[model samples]
Target: MLLLQQSSWALYEPVPESYYVHQKNINSVTFEENTTTYLSGQWQYYPKQLLQTATPTRPSRTVLLPISFKEMGYPQNTYGTFIGHFKIPKEFIGRRIAIWIPNQYGAYRMYLNGDFLLRLGKVGKTIQTQQTENAPRFAYFIAESEYFTVTMQVSSFQSLHGGLENPMRIGVSQTVNRQFQQLMMSIAGVCGAVIGVGVFTILFAIFRGVRHSQSQGFFVFGIFIIFLALHNLFSAPYVYTVFTNIDWLWGTRLEYIFTYLSAFFFINYMFLLNQRYLHPAVFTIAVFVLSFNIVITFLSVPEVFEKLVFYSFLLGIIVVLNFAYGFYQTVNRHEPYSTINLWAVVLLCVTFLHDFLLSLNWIDSVNLSFASTSFYAFLIMVQQSKNYAYHSSRIEKLNNNLLCTRQIS
Candidate 1:
């Protein structure tokens, strides 16, 4: 029998804590020969819901899904089921196990060995009937048997993508729970830092910008950072556990709204900082993108609005790339504050791409993009402070020159 393998090098094998199973996009199931067997390969997919009494037949198509359903070529706004088989490592049998879904859109239910295990949100055939889950969740169950059959029924009426975007993992309940807590702490740190930075910049812009006026960028940028921070906080699965008042639906909606607003303001901030390097066309593109987001938010239902946000995020990449090119030119010209701007742009571009991938379920990691925003704001504030001092000195020199000229006359 052929067992699934990741690569030729055993040195690169999966760690003991977790095994990254190879998943196929097809809809079918393969039972194990023995209780010790590890099942991998194509999982049967049924794009329609299975009746409570029905069992799935052979899947119609086979594909790979290391990312979200939108990228997996699945039809938008659909419901489906995925069935696969896996075995518990003998050491983990009888131990408490936690199932980890890195990312998925819509609502879903999980079953183990044909028994109902856990469900997130509400899975229904229609949008009005369906409920959505925004935060990540950990489903802990006892490994009653060595061999397990798993099924996931998912629906996505509100999101652009559905199905399992990233791979799932099963590990000891304690270990997984610990990891979850660490992730929460890391995200909380990011949120707190962003709020602190936001308040400082906004105040500086109001008091200081009133005099210099060049600090307008700080005001817009501060608001943008706050939105981005909220997005991160709301998206983290742990937030729901702490803030029970916030439901998955509104939390997710606000996450989308904040993301769209942040992108809109980000372009404005960049343009304010370096009008020489930025072009009217780039600003126009940003405006068009923001307008599209507004129309979608108002015209479409919350579910659709949330799903469509990914497209806006894609457009944001283009905006950032444009800014990167402009910053490169500034660096070449050795303009005042250009060095700081150049580095900040580079850092932002990298973090933006990282978070974008995470959003699409293309990658999974603790998001550090919020931290980058703080760094960028700090650099811009420093540059503005320097410019203020230079202006004051220039005025002082001119007044001195006027006095000497009068004395000579």
Candidate 2:
């Protein structure tokens, strides 16, 4: 039996005896009152077809909540029905009770007291609320006694990109936590890719005797690119193996580094496009701004630093736009290295805008995974641009030598 009591600010669920208690007090903050119940155990589950003709007289298998049926050796099929009976406690009378379902890959239909409560279809979290009156979906009756039998039936559909045997379970608290974790992981992966490619590119350039030259813009870009990747990794939960002592410091520093290096890379890229047209004054001002932001990030308090980062992101976007415009202008002028460079700049702008909008919660459907892939494509374009520029310069020199020989003859 599940008992729920609703308060003005919070909900309360009486702790069940069968609930598994993992950790009670580790860096814990005591709430005014605890308002959650662990509803996990052997739930009566079967294939969807088995439920239409007849309900099983005896349970074929008992599954756990907050877990996928596939985790229990069930086939990777969806649309199974879950039926469970719970007892309502007398203490929960006259309170608003709600169910929290974590998000799965696709859709879910839920019933309580034999009445449909809600239908949800998405890849994120969802919460369902219902009144105790009016013949609940599974079964919730006003009991004259201390306890009443409550029932719930849930049906979920398979995901579109079906590879995983286990889908994420749906419920409120778990869904919120899982989404947050996923966002961090996505950021980490992006950072790792940026760093990995940058390192290889830098080493390759140096091996080719392109040390500290204007052509080394690629290497400079690589340094900051990798720094940003490391930044993301440090900010996530999966940072146990490397740089363990100053995790928080690295995370904070990388936030500043991302903006500074991105600006620096843009400036250097412009220099590569045209050394004469590169505005030294503008580069100087950008450097000053970057340094100022880094200092602010380190000195401000944690909450204040977070706000500053958001503002800095806006500034960074403007700077990126400036670079994009420069690239466009160079390409329009038919500059020596325009073709591949312009493509790289265009791709970078698209991916940056896509990711920025997603981070701000402006677009719900944008996948960071796909966005990162686009960024990698942009990197490849930039590499091709470097190769074209090198080969073209060499050919021009050879043509000049031939002309000199003809004049001497």
Candidate 3:
């Protein structure tokens, strides 16, 4: 069983051995254990400015998981730490023990048995100096004693979300590593697919010279996908491999900036797709939104501008809804293929809104926006090809008619 106790900063003592062992069949052993059980209970939380003090005082109160710094009453840009101690079971001794963390919001240090085992990015006092390492990491230490302690000092000066948002687990090294590898592979494959499609569509438009509004629309959509993919990649922990030593402030700024760019191009793409509506104001709105995002990116660091991103996204929703409404009205006007565009735009807007809410901590839902967006993009690509063919056929017929008329004359 887990224990929750409040104390000023001090070393955690081993728990009494009389407690029952929660074990099951793991790794051919008669009893297996879930690593999460070890981390489930309350932890001692220290808010703001972790110092190198020899003995930090215990926390004043408790904070729960699935909570953010904003909700915790911490200012926009702040840092915090969480400390937890768990008993090493007699059975775990002599085994290569490892701990797996699902998600950590920012830079952090993981300590085992009072020894620093792993550091993700550089934890610092401010965003300017803080280097964020956002990656899944695990360290192996032979269980030498009957108890062990895990302390995490996590710092966040950029994101709206902060702290330990997911449960961690301790288990055999091989099992944990395998799980982490699988998760990384899945993310990599998805990112690869988006990049591939984005590149192909953009190249096709460029080489074809974008003769009509339909082709231009496709090109804009491609740009949106490319930037969206970049945003996802930069937001991942693995990005540290490529951009090692990146300042946390700049990294987050770029991530959200890419997001804004994607939104901008998406609106432009929608307008170009259905030209019969011919609304000039939509283009003006897209330009205004894009300019706003670009100005803010240069004006402030992430901690200050992060809130603006959310609000700007909220404002962008108005543009998205307007586009969808236009498409719906076009369908009423008996415009060809307008129904398909209407549904696609509606679905895309919903996905975008859901993800925005998820980022803001207003709601929790599995983010399937990327997958849905990809599906709709593919459909649009196919339809754009058809539109091009249709226009070509009409032009060819018109030329033939003109030639016959001149011959008769």
Candidate 4:
């Protein structure tokens, strides 16, 4: 109890929590210096309305920001306007302020204090006119006064759910810039590491291969990891898409392709490892389904392909179960390092489940993408190491036999 109390006391934040907008009250909120704040909480929601002007209007309802429109009783292809207010501190008036707008479901235009600001894609009233583009962006404005109003005109015609799926960050230039840079750096570092491991794994597999050995497992694993890494690097609503000159539609397509194909390779890897346990028919079916999904993803638009993700996730669950059962059988047979392999499978499965649920919006939170990637990379390393040891032992035994024959001669 004493230790718990001490730890709780140690969790004190550096700044006060007085900056939050409560019950539509922005006057009492004071902007903190160098502190990043998410522009969440209640915002005016006007459904089926798209305004081109920054002029404020009466809202039909108030809904929380960063909420899925489907959960809020809105159907697909909903268009709306959202209004948020935050007051700048007296000292910060006339100074430069920055807002970090993360990716949302559709196209949007941001306005601050009745002035045109950031426009991401083209917001329109109909499917033909509406151009959807999802990406992380930033907007800067000089605080003309203490009271600042943010107006957003948004539309989602090609997505499953509309409205702001991600919370926007608001802060001073220095703090926001630092946070953005750190985010990008961290993403780059992680993807770079995954890519390196994949390359090394492929090379290692080639080095260990001979006329009699099955080294294609490692090769397949390495290829999948590379694709997965690419998926992570060029994830939608991220900076890499901007660098790659991809809009949300193409970026999302790449995500689905990389993700599905990586699973495809992984399934083949499993079949190679436990051919008897995983039936050939089942493996073939899985491959066919994944391939079909990839084709449909490329041909169909966002609305059409997004619905197919649920079925893909269902297939993924079946695949994970197969892996679990195979590992369990291995452990029961008392094979060497079987226990470790089983536990690794369990860890990998858990991460897969977490991300899978998040994708379905059943988790109501962000996906543990990087964590899942790390766990996968760890699993790859473990299996590769095991393969390496087995080959080394085999080589040693062959060398010993040759020496014995020479001595006898």
TM-score of each: 0.71, 0.45, 0.74, 0.84
Question: lDDT of model 4 at residue 312?
Answer: 69
Evaluate model 3: give its lDDT. Answer: 0.64
Predicted model with the maximum TM-score:
4
**Mind giving the per-residue lDDT tens digits that candidate 1 earns over 255-289?**
66666777777777778877754677878877887
Give lDDT for model 4.
0.71
Task: State the C-alpha lDDT per candidate.
Answer: 0.64, 0.46, 0.64, 0.71
Candidate 1's TM-score reads: 0.71
lDDT score at residue 48, model 2, on the 0-100 scale: 42
Per-residue accuracy of model 4 over 1-409 as CA lDDT, tens digit each: 1111100001112122343333344433444786878777667777777653333354567677787778778876778888776666778766667778877878888776556677888988888998998777777766656666677888888987677878888777667767877777777778788888989978877887823245787787788788878877756336465346666788888888888887788777678667744667778888999899999999989788888888767877777777767666766887654445456556766876887777667787666666677676877688767867998999999999999999999
lDDT measured at residue 192 in model 2 versus the true structure, 0 to 100: 63
Which sections of candidate 1 miss by over 4 Å? 1-42, 49-74, 235-244, 280-292, 302-334, 350-409
Backbone clashes under 3 angstroms, per model = 6, 21, 11, 0
User: Superposing all C-alpha atoms, what RMSD in Å does each candidate have to the true structure?
Assistant: 9.8, 18.1, 7.7, 8.4
Residue runs of model 4 more than 4 Å from their true location after superposition: 1-24, 27-32, 52-59, 210-214, 337-340, 382-409
Model 1 pairs whose backbones collide? 25-63, 27-44, 27-45, 27-59, 28-44, 158-303
* Residue-wise C-alpha lDDT for candidate 3, range 1-409, written one tens digit per residue: 0011110122233333442143111122221453323354555567874632113454534565545667778764567666554555578766776666654667777776465667766787898877764545555667665655566777876566677765666676666655555555565677778878888888878887888665686678789888877766655444433335455556666777777787777767766776443367756866786778778887886656777766677567667667656766766777666455666777877887887787777886756566667667667766766877999999999999999999999
Models ranked on TM-score: 4, 3, 1, 2
